[model samples]
Target: MDLQLPRGMRDFPPEEKILRDEVIAILKNLFELYGFSPLETPVVERWEALSAKYSGGEEILKETFKLTDQGGRQLGLRYDLTVPLARFVGMNPTIKRPFKRYQIGTVYRDGPIKKGRTREFYQCDADIVGSSSPLADAECVQLALDVFERFKIDVVVKINNRKVLYELVRAAQIPEKFTEAAILSLDKLDKIGPDEVIREMVERGIERTSAERFLSGAQDPQAFKNSEGYRELEPVLSALRDSRVVWTPSLARGLSYYTGTIYEVYAKDSSVTGSLAAGGRYDNMIGQFLGGTEKIPAVGISFGLEPILEVLKEQRRDLPLRKTVTQVYVIPFKTLVAEGRAVCQRLRRAGIKTDIDFSAKGISDGLKYANAYAIPFVVIVGPDEVAQGKVKLRDMRSGEEQLLTVEEVARQVAQRLS
Candidate 1:
C-alpha cells in the first residue's frame, strides 16, 4: 500500500516548521508583553462540554469531529481554543477574577478543506476574563495589530458589536428568534456577496425589504450612534482610534457565544482570503458553563496561524531557512576523528551550536554537506592541525580559511553568527 497523509492534513517540513515556530514565538512574546499569562488545555473534550450551547453555535457544532473512547465515553477533538478556555474558567472559580491568559495550540474541525481552512490548524488565543471594560476589547485589537505589524503585513481590523447587530435586525423588523441565523448569514457577506446574503436572510424568515434595510444600516456606521450596539462599541473605537480599526457592522462573527463586540482581521492586500484572526466578547459563555445564571464578562482574539502562514507564503515573507541547527560543522581527516570530537565538544561547551561529521568523507564531501545545509562555518582537523593544537576554520560563505586554536575558533564563529 502506498503511504499517504489523510486529506485536509499537512506535514510541515523543517523550513515551514521554522517559520511557523517563529510566528508562534512572536505571538507569545506579544501576549506576554501585554500582560497575558500562558495557558494550555487538552485537545480532547467531552462531547457534552462542546455541544452547540457552549461551543459557539450550531455551525461549529456541526463541524466538530465526534468519537467514542474504549470506556464508551463520548469525546470530540476541540474545534477551537475558546471553548476549552471557557470550560477552564468555569471549573476553576478559585482562579483570580479577570484572568488573562494566552494559549497556542492545534485545534481540529471536520469542515471542508480549502486554501486557508484545514481539518487541523494552530490557533493563538489571548483572552481577558471578568472585565467588562471595552479597554479589554481594545487591547485584543491592539495585540492583533501588533502581531501583524511585526510581520510587516498590512491588515485592517473590522469591529462590530452583537448588540448593534441586534438593533439593526430590530430595525429591519426581523424577529428576535432569527437573529442568530441572520448574523450567521451576514458573516458570509464578503464571501457570498450582498445579493446572496439577502436571499439567505429571506430564507431565514426575514422580510426582503427588512433584510436590505438591515444590510444598508451595516454599511452606515454613523447612522446608529444612539443605538445600543454603537453605544457599547464607542469606547472600544475610542481606545483604538490610533489603530487601523473600522466600525464594520456587517462583521457579525459566526460564534453564538459573542454577546458584545466582535471583530475580524483581514490582510489589506494579499491573495490569501478569509480572516487572519478573529474573536469577540463572550460575556455569557463562561456563565453557561457554571449554570447560565452568572454573567462573566470575557473577550478574546484568536490568530489563525494557518491562514497567516498562507498569506506569508504567498507574499514570500519568510525567514531564511536553516536546514540544520548546527552552526559549525567539524570535518576530520581519516585518522583525526577523535580530535574532531574534542573540538566539537569544546565548541558546544562554549554554548555554540556545533556538529561533527562521522561519515569519514573527504574534505570535498564535508564541504558539500555543510554548504547544502547553509552551515556558516566548517572546521577541518587533520594530523598537522591536531599536532599544532589548532583547527582550520573555513568560512563557508567567503571560502576564507584560517588556522586558530579550538577556543579561538569557537569564539570567532559565535561572534560571526551573532
Candidate 2:
C-alpha cells in the first residue's frame, strides 16, 4: 500500500523555497518599518470561534477543513488570518489598545486548484485594530501600496465604503428588509454586468424602480457627494490626495465583517477580477466574540502571495529574481581538508556568507555545484598553497583564478563580490 498527499496541495522544492523566503524577508522588513509587530496564532482553532464570528458566504463555511479533536471538541483549520487575529484580540483584551500586528502563515481551504486560487497556501497580513476613522482605512491602503512597491509591482489601489453602499440602498428606496441581498448583488457589480446586478436585485425582491435607481445613481460621484458615507470618508480621500495617491471608488470586497471602508489592489494593465491584496474596516469584529460590549474599531490588509507570484511569472522582466545569500563556497583539494575548514571559518567570521564542501567532492565537481547554485566565488585550498599560507580563489562567473594568502583572499573576494 502507498500513501499519497491530497489534491490542491504541493511540496515546495529548493528553488521555490528560496523564492518564498525572499518574499517573506521583504514583507517582514517592510512590516517592521511600518510599526507593525509580529504576532502568530494557532493554525487550528475551535470551529465555533471562526464560524460563529462571521456570517461569511456559504463557500467559507463548507470549504473549511473541520474535524473532531481528541477531546471531542470540533476544530477547523483557519481559512484566513483575519479571523484568527480577531480571536486573538478577543482572547487578550489586556494588550495595548489600537494594536498593530503582522502575520505570515499558511491557511487551508477546499477550493479547486487553479492559478490564483489554492486549497492550502500562505498569506501575508498586516492589520491595525481599534480604529474606525477612515484614516485607519487610509493607512491600510498605504500599507498595501508599500508592500507592492517593495515587490516592484505597479498597482492601482481601489477604495470604496460599505456605508456608501448601504446609503445608496436607502437612497434608492430599496426596502429595508432586502438590504443584505442588495449589498451582495452590488458587491458583484464588477464580476457580472450592471444588467445582471439589476436582475439579482429583482430576484432578491428589490422593487424595479429602486433597482434602476441604484444601478444609475450608484455610479455617479456627485450623487454621493452630499451623502453620509461620502461626508465621513471625504477627509480620508483628501488626505490621500494631498499625498498624491490615486484612489478609486469601485472596490466592494465581498465579505460580511467589512462594515465601512473596503479596498483592493490590481495590476494596472490586467483585467483579472481576483485581487492581489485586499481588506477592509471591520469595527465590530472583535466585539463579536467579546459580547459586543467594547467597540474596537479595526482595519487590515492581506497580500495573496500565490497570486502575486503568478503575476510576477507573467511580468518576469519587472520582477527581481531571488539571489542566493551564500556569497562564497570553500572547496579544498584532497590533501588540504583542514585548511579548507579554516578558510570557510575565516570568510564567515568576516561576515561573508561562506560554506565548506564537506562532501569531499573533487574540485571540478565542487566548482560545478557552486556554479549550479549560483555561488559567486570559490576559495580553493590545496597542500602546496596551504603550506604557503595561501589559497586559490576563483571567480565563478568569469572563471578567473588567482592565488592569495587566506587573509588577502577574503579581502579580494569581498572586493570582487562587492
Give me the displacement of residue 261 in model 2, in angstroms.
1.2
Alpha-carbon RMSD of each model: 1.7, 2.8
* Candidate 1 residue spans exceeding 4 A from truth: 317-320
Evaluate model 2: give its TM-score: 0.89
lDDT value, residue 106 of candidate 1: 95
lDDT of 2 by residue, 324-401 (tens): 667888899876778788888888888788988887779988998898888888888888777787888888889999
The digit string of per-residue lDDT tens for model 1 on 1-418 reads 9999888898988878878888888888999999999999999999988994856689988888899999999999999999999999989977897899999999998888888998999999999999999999999999998899998889999998999888888888888898888889988899899999999989888889988998898888787878888888999999888568988878888888889999999998788788999999998889989887788899999999999988888777555665767789999998888888988899999998999889878999999999988999999999898889899999999999999998999889888988
Backbone clashes in model 1: 1
- Regions more than 4 Å wrong, model 2: 1-5, 53-59, 195-212, 242-250, 270-273, 317-325, 411-418
What is the Cα root-mean-square deviation between model 1 and the actual structure?
A: 1.7
Query: For candidate 2, which ten residues in a row score worst on lDDT?
Result: 242-251
